[model samples]
Target: MKQMLAWQDISRQGAHQGIARMHKAHRDLLDTIELAGRVRSEHPQISCRDIHYAARGQMPRGRDWTEQLLLSCGFRVKTPPRSFTVAGQGVCANLIEGMSITGANQLWQTDITYVWAGRRWYYVSFVVDVYTRRILASHCSRDLSSASQIRCLSGALSRVAGQDLSGLIVHTDRGIQYTSGEYKRYLESHGLRHSMARYAWQNAYCERVNRTIKEGYLQHYTTDSYSSLAAGVCRAVRLYNHSKPHRGLPCRLSPDQFVKELNQGLHPDYRVNIWSKLTSTKMLYVN
Candidate 1:
């Protein structure tokens, strides 16, 4: 109740858009509690700070309130994780920038990567909505099976339910899962186009994102149980969606914000693929 009052007080001083953003932030904060609980149960060994950092994704305000709340709940909230894998050698073998965007949702990229869960190896598959830099779906499993890929893909599709995905171009590397007949039929059934990145650079955007998750997000903590990794990934997804700022979007807007603005009839300042032209002195070029 006190937290709600404080939130309302802060929100009252802002513009309508600012108030809306605050409301959204408050809602997201509340939602993170449930997400954090599920994550902590699955990955029981993750620290409260680690989970909180993953939930907020940036410098947190009103953190004392959170700490007190957790302490009241019998959870000890401590300092943030000191994982510096992002700067360590051999942690990431990919560069962070440089990718082409034809249009929004035009190119969806998929990939698989390996992570260490205890002494065993776990594989994770991710499907990213390339335009907004949002990870639509991800799943980690002991083995890379067509069923796993199907599950991830289905989750991604379900997130966009009731929407027209026609003309969507799905881009992926030449993985067997991507080239498999079942995957091909699924794409065809949805009237979605397909493309493959024959070279590693073609998929660099998703690669960088994956590296960020493994290094900045996942590798920062010591998890006593492998299930913690799954929880970490889920928490990471929520942060990635609602909190983390991407360089691609101005105002540090999240992927969810970009989508919301689009749905609310806000137009982008820069063009994605829409071309403009001025006619020449004597002629105009025609396609």
Candidate 2:
């Protein structure tokens, strides 16, 4: 009986010592976990990999370790909702497919998304520069009209006024606002080529911008009123352009930072060919 009591005491001491070591290890991780939490709070929809990249200066652990730590700390990562696209007739050809995109202003993509605010739905039109993945302009309205689209496009054009836009191609899905006579006339007057996607996937870049704005930034802001929604949209655009790190960009620089570096000749211009399965299949058959 004495020997049994001694064994039980030893087992209890071992368990306590193991728990103490675990507690100390967790205590040491408090600062890193807090920093990660702050990053996640600021960008609610950011992935764990991005969080680690953003906070790499302060984090001592690697990417996989950071992700595991976040999970163990009870940080629930939310997956974005799935999107579906439908085929449609297009008024213009897909000019960007398989085309080599080398720099900004060469190709711009636009799209519209609905945002719920003030107990109603508000439509927002966004124009993004494909090469830099930067949102150049956006306009919010109560209805999906060509007027809003024109205003949005006008804003984008005004930003680069006096620059040569004759070679610029504006891509969009086959939506009524983009196909309207007024919109087409505006594009012609501005000397911008009209490129329409027959399938929604053809305009993948702009579609991603829509999701980033709606899911990453706007969803976390107050939008109970029209004014709030407009303000939120503005704030989201600024954050996305100035701070959000783009994985596609060199060094994962933000859009604004990439533009700055490019202007300074710090980075070389690279060609990005538009991806299309049909184009690949056709090439294979020809070969």
Candidate 3:
């Protein structure tokens, strides 16, 4: 017998005239997920996973059912895949795995993944602060271009314009935008160094951020346009940066909280740093 708990309880009742094959258990969960999302928006520190565990009384194994239901509703879900093919032929060092990141913006990683908006897929590029696990910048576009990449870089630079970026490193998998002449010039002009993962596995951190947003956040909401998805991305990043605690960090503090402590000259506090704002984005496509 497949013990879904409710079924087991029903059988234990001993007197059931008839049973409906489908129950509204999953349907009823929508309300819980919505409540969780609302709390996440306002509080940002309340973990959605914890909400699910409390709602379902146990963690459900497999994809988030809410996400699965949304996907079933006609959204083209995109997952970051292993890129076995070679990237733009370029020489760059690997900065994440073996390197020690002491603070925010010392090392930043960027990656572009697709998000479904309205009817078509839009490219979403994110620049993450490696030390704090904070999303410093994100932008979406109809086409994969250096412009999007530049915008992400620009956002990061704008935040730290007067500070020395000589020690900072921007890492990414070798892609056209990354390897393009213009992109290289921009990095050189800004005095920012470039780093590349030798293999797909080397890009794990950035990819994890991509998965976190697409699977953990995007899947929970139904977005119809690039603007909607972008706004959703903002909401999701805000929650993650302000709430989610990283195991690697000291005190298990959220990125924002950690960063705030560090910037106050609290040495050995093992904190993080920075505040970020997403740029306005609007674009739509239909399949």
User: Could you say which candidate leads in TM-score?
Assistant: 2
Give the per-residue lDDT of model 2 (tens digit) for 165-219.
7699999888888878888999998778999987767898888888888998888
Q: Which residue pairs clash in candidate 2?
A: none
Q: lDDT-based ranking, best first?
A: 2, 3, 1
Error of 3 at 210 (Å): 0.7
Per-residue C-alpha lDDT of model 3 across residues 165-203, encoded as one tens digit per residue: 777888888888888888888898887888887566567
lDDT of each: 0.64, 0.83, 0.68
The whole-model C-alpha lDDT of candidate 2 against the native structure comes to 0.83
The TM-score values for the models, in the order shown, are: 0.58, 0.84, 0.65
Per-residue lDDT tens digits for candidate 1, residues 138-190, read: 89878877678878878888988887676777776666777777777787887
Question: What's model 2's lDDT at 59?
Answer: 77
Indicate the residue-level lDDT of 158 in model 3: 83
- Which residue segments of model 1 deviate by more than 4 Å? 1-103, 224-226, 271-287
TM-score of candidate 2 against the unseen true structure: 0.84
Show model 3 residue runs off by greater than 4 Å: 1-86, 95-97, 267-287
lDDT of 3 at 163: 73
* TM-score preference between candidates 1 and 2, better one: 2
